[model samples]
Target: PVHDDDDDDDDALITDAITGKRYRALRHEEAESLSDHLLSLWMRAGPGRGAELPVDSYKESVLEAVRASQVVVMVVITGCGKTTRIPRFLLEGQVRRVRRAECNILVTQPRRISAVSVAHRVAQEMGPALRHCVGYQVRLESRPPERSGGALLFLTVGVLLRKLQSNPGLQGISHVIVDEVHERDVNTDLLLALLLSSIKNNPDLRVLLMSATGDTQRLSQYFGGCPVVHVPGFMHPVQARFLEEVLTEMGRPTPPRRDREEEKEVAPDLDLVADVIDHIHSNREPGKDAFRADRRGRAGRCQPGHSYHLFPRKQLDRMAVFPVPEILRTPLESVIIQAKIHCPHSKAVDFLAQVLDSPDSQVVRVAVKSLMDIGVLDAAENLTPLGERVACMSCDPRLGKALVLSALFSCVLPVLSVAACLTRDPFYNSMQNRALVSKAKAALSGSSCSDHLVFSRVVQSWKELQGRESKQEFLDQYTLSGASLRFIHGLMQQFGENLCEAGLLDASAECLRLSSGLNQHSQQEQLVKAVLIAGLYPHLIQVKRGTVTKGGRYRPENLSYRTESGPVLLHRSSANRGNPDLSSRWLTFFSAVKSNGQVFIRDSSVVHPLALLLLTDCDLSERGNARPNHSVLLPGHSLIRWEFSPHVWELLWDLRTSLQAMIHRSLRRCDRRSTSGGCKDSELVALLVELLNNTDPEPGSDQEEFSTENIRSDRL
Candidate 1:
């Protein structure tokens, strides 16, 4: 519970004359009455520069539209003060006048950084009392101060979705503004659908959807033809150009993409983009035509909501209007599970299909089918016991599954750290310090191929540094953000608490013994990799015998062990990038994307093929071929061939089946009581570790071979 310093005084009580009820006396009432200072407080707590913004002219209309309807669509430009001022306007201007019901404004931002910074800016604009009035809630931090009377909450969309788990109707919040709806994440899309469904029962609830550029007509129609309001602001006109035109202007020929799949979705060519920008800077007068250079002579500056010229103009054309919706770009396992919880009686595909600007139908079908295969959902697309547990975890379904299995397998701490690192940014190295950062990362990795282990080492180093030096020194040495480290630490504690809350951890000696077995560094590393394999089996890849030239540099070709997406390169940030000897032959990756016209795996770990097969759902391929041609079928419809006798193959399958049953039983037994049951087979654990130890090490590629720079230059 959060304690308000202002309301903690014991000597500030007052008794009503007739009712005999005790209440805390107002702080201002000690010297001045409430009515005497109302106007002064209002002026201080309102918009700081209300006269300068275009939004001020339409403030009264915005309030009136909300009062008359249940929904409103706001089309505001980048810097029009819509995000920070609208909530304050509603709380002070309209809700105070009505006095029928206390109003609580909840604003949702698409990004966490925006949510926290906006909350701080709003609090600073207001005076002292308004400081307490404005609070923010994100994944790892929350300051919910006295939400009953009048409060302005700035939260990420994910937090609001979690709140809906308990308060589906959003009982206390009078109005909710879903900001940045154009950059549609899965959570934002889900929130819109939930609000649309709930508003029918909650006629008094008000919702405002704000975006810089959106499908206003379609969204307004979705909200029952809600009134649309556009607030204009000042912005410079931007020119667009084609890749060929820019390259020709730079006196260079167009470069070819590495493969055919890359043509579908290619990141902007940054080299060509930089050359074009330089040409523009040399040809035009800076003060009149473009942003003036700073003392450091960096000519271009990326503003908060404006696009930068560091990407191919063609790609910028698409991003100028909107970002690629996350549903189409990212894996949808967690989303499918959330949909199941929201519409338990309906099919997951059917429910997601109804969402506005619904994602690809084939994508939804594939996600649902994958979940069913993982045993999270049944054949009917209903949540199983494991699915319910996974739904409550604040992570991707795959990572959440890894956490659960880690607890059952007695390696929760390391896996918890890994999950936290994945959720939060642990490293913030800039291009100038890339060499030093790479060296430090290598030292932390301790010759492990797994980036997850490297992250754990970095976190441990940070903890050690906390006692010896200042935070600034640590940040400088590690090229990390201090805020990001604190956020990760908070998430670590929260994940531990969640384990206890889910009954997946306990005080029993047996459970403690299993977890304690991972005290040794070697033991911990092996178990962590095993849990990872269990979670991310089909994403494994292998080194193919080929070479490709990317950006005038040659690197070995990589292929997925299952899907065969070829010519993949290790991301520049990976610890294993420059090491000639990789830890293992096969690898498991978190994400694969085409950036800069090259395929790259973001975070990856090398794993033994035999170790991976242990976690796979083993079944014989359906073919009427000879015995030598028979192969084992794996998840994602992948097949693996090995030269083993039929008897030995049957024995391995039996062991895998046994391991699968033990994992299922242990997870099901984890309930509100305590985690007590798990496999205690020492020989099996030792054998799996031994197989991983005996695998041939992977040959590493050059770190500077490929450049995977971010194409989206701005975070608007």
Candidate 2:
């Protein structure tokens, strides 16, 4: 049987003690029933079409290519049957090959849609025993093969990475194929780096990397001169006479930014890409005016050369990408409607719609919409799969938070922390009523960091509301914002499901098991923090000593700076209003803060300062003294900066590693328990202790590291 961890090559299938019928893996009917809820989601689009053979007479080329070489690079351009044909080819290959080389085929995508859709299509095409030959593995669910011999596995790059980490470099499957390399996601890039570095050591491993015509050269070079087999698509090649040649020249005086923006449509080898695209354009179906390129590639008008073989826009989704400076392109009407509902008549609301949706709004607007569409908008009216995934993470302001949250799945309370992190932005505006926020912050400082003061104050007012049972009443009496509460509720639901999927159905089992019958006071507390920490660990930033503000008190940047002074709350008037209690002191949480006209959270994670300082970069020195002292300035982002220690650096490294390991251990133990159902409370406690121990450092000295600390506190 294919265990949850297929990486466990030696693991024997579970068997019944009495019957010895070798726990005859789940029956098709039972499996279907169990996954009925999940399948209902896909099936809801109604029954879709299955894979089919090409209408044109057969070309053994597709199947033959994969069969001949261990690793095959099939460059079948858009619509020429790459997606469908490739998986079918592998199934055929498995049937023909007899040796152990008859292992499963792993096909990975840059997004979830392709992964999920492709698997369903493949299974429908393959017919019966798909449970044994065709399967899928994505973020929330999996339909893996029972015996694992010939199944074709479709997964996302992130999932594959986790599988690799889980199995320490892909233990099972003999063939490894990577699909869609041009998308250029962080995860895809990282996976390539890992494979490239290790393929030599893994001779049994056959690597197949595929992509569009434009960027396949790099893949070839990366694979140690692997022979490339190119299959031209129906797309006709067109030459872009020149970028300006295709772009309509403006008669009126145009702004330079606009002029500059126009050129971005044809970037880098602009002339070349546009040329080929134009050729494909002329040869496209007479009436299919879809899948066109944009000024800079937004969900806007398609460029001319999309004729021959561009992915039809109407048929599928736009290849939406957000690499560096993310864009939040949204329809004006939708953003305006959302803003009006969020905070009617408020300037921020008006600005949220305009500045973010202005004609010139590219990075921020597109980023916001992309974030929102994918569930990055914690306060969205409705949630989508991508959005749900973002909401599934701990609070940070980036789109890539799921990775960190995924790590937490193995830890106790990962669900709780993920809920809290995703639900509330951890720094409330303290300056709105600087005095009131000051009161809340002061009420929170030290004193167990449990919000004894803030909770008591809020509860006192809340209790006065007599009918606090109502969500609105409870929110109003406690001075809680509706937006914040909305996020929390949604986050709670999403995290709950995540725990269930990870096999830790009883949230109460992890301490946060506060769901009534599974109730206990302060139950959700540690779990919430633990999951948040788990998701936010590697980004940890401990506060540096001696960094104090001019007022001679603690700066919220570091826990070390927090003292008897009690200045731990966020300022009210400042913009980036995050939660007060969960907000880091010496820790600077990081995420992809989309640059809308106003900056807002995207994908994010929260953790200690030391964690990020240690893992992502090294505190190198000219002669042993620290060189790049700030942790955030290490790699990927030169603009990100955070000041902290280099001494506990190694200690922070060990701590983050330990914390992650604990989460993994907890997951394995829990998964095993489903079959074993027994674990020591002491063992659970031990994992929890590893996460919380030594979280605090000496109150930092009076120094200031941040140029400006934005706040949103109690009053506003």
Q: Rate the local accuracy (lDDT) of all candidates.
A: 0.65, 0.43
Worst 10 residues of 2 by lDDT: 707-716
What TM-score number comes out for model 2?
Answer: 0.45
- Name the Cα RMSD for model 2: 17.3
Candidate 1: pairs in clash:
541-561
Stretches > 4 Å off in candidate 2: 1-59, 97-101, 128-132, 169-171, 196-202, 236-716
For residue 587, what is the lDDT in candidate 2? 37
* Model 1 misplaced stretches (Cα beyond 4 Å): 1-52, 98-101, 232-324, 423-443, 466-484, 497-501, 506-522, 543-584, 595-598, 620-658, 670-673, 678-716
Q: What is the TM-score of each candidate against the true structure?
A: 0.73, 0.45
Model 2's alpha-carbon lDDT is 0.43
Top TM-score prediction, candidate number: 1
Candidate 1 matches the true fold with a TM-score of: 0.73
